[model samples]
Target: MFDGVARWWDGFELWLAQQWFPVQFVLVAAVLLPLCVGMAWVIHRGVEAVADRLGRLCRADAAGNGHGVVDEGHGGRPDAVS
Candidate 1:
């Protein structure tokens, strides 16, 4: 009863495994790994820029709406948006 189905699966499983061999290799070693590294670099740069801007704000002595006032001490850093 189950003999025909079992035989078919035995042949098909080998072919399916061979086809998926390269797909699994490329997904981990070529695609996902590099994308993870690139995304991390982008995030690091973005966070650094925000931190630098915040540091400038903390060190300055701005009056009014934190705009127009020139920060001569810090080489005129631009005001952060509200």
Candidate 2:
């Protein structure tokens, strides 16, 4: 199966190499445009999910006491978030 596909890909590559520049350009654009768009969409969704998680954590921290606020600890120094 792998060898079959590899041979087919080699034949296709040879055919594409012999094609006109416009045809090559069109094929590249046709393949790359959707691939780039899909990658961008996935990245955007991932970033959105991360932002949502961070927002929830921030809200939770804000709702709790002594979070993001400097309170005196055992040595009268500002305490870290707990």
Candidate 3:
């Protein structure tokens, strides 16, 4: 199976190498540009998801009393407002 796949790939590579310059450029760009954009979008979304999760964790840790206020004193406890 692997040998068959390799042989097909070699033939494809040779065919690409024999194409005219403009045709080759268009073919490479048509195959690669969308792939690059898709990968970048996926990476961006993954980073955004991780950032959102970390933000939520930090907010939860800061808001110890569930009121969303971080205490600047009293050893990191929730602040009490009168």
The lDDT for every candidate, in the order shown, is 0.71, 0.78, 0.81
Clashing pairs for predicted structure model 1, backbone only:
none
Predicted candidate 3 versus true structure: per-residue lDDT over 1-82, tens digit per residue: 9999999999999999999999999999999999999999999999978876776677677676676675456543233353
Give candidate 2's total backbone clashes: 0
In model 1, which runs have C-alpha deviations exceeding 4 angstroms?
A: 1-23, 62-82
lDDT of 2 by residue, 1-82 (tens): 9999999999999999999999999999999999999999999999978876776566567658655643345332222354
Scored against the true structure, residue 20 in model 3 reaches a CA lDDT of 96
- Structural similarity to truth (TM-score) of each candidate: 0.46, 0.77, 0.77
Best candidate, lDDT: 3
Ranking by lDDT: 3, 2, 1
The deviation in Å at residue 12 for candidate 2 is 0.6
Residues 1-82 of candidate 1: C-alpha lDDT, one tens digit per residue: 6999999988876665676777757655786788999999999999989987885676564554575555556444554443
Candidate 3 backbone overlaps, count: 0
Weakest ten-residue segment in model 1 by summed lDDT: 73-82
How good is model 2 by TM-score? 0.77
- Which residues of candidate 3, in runs, are more than 4 Å off? 65-82
TM-score: the better of candidates 1 and 3: 3
Q: Name the top TM-score candidate.
A: 2
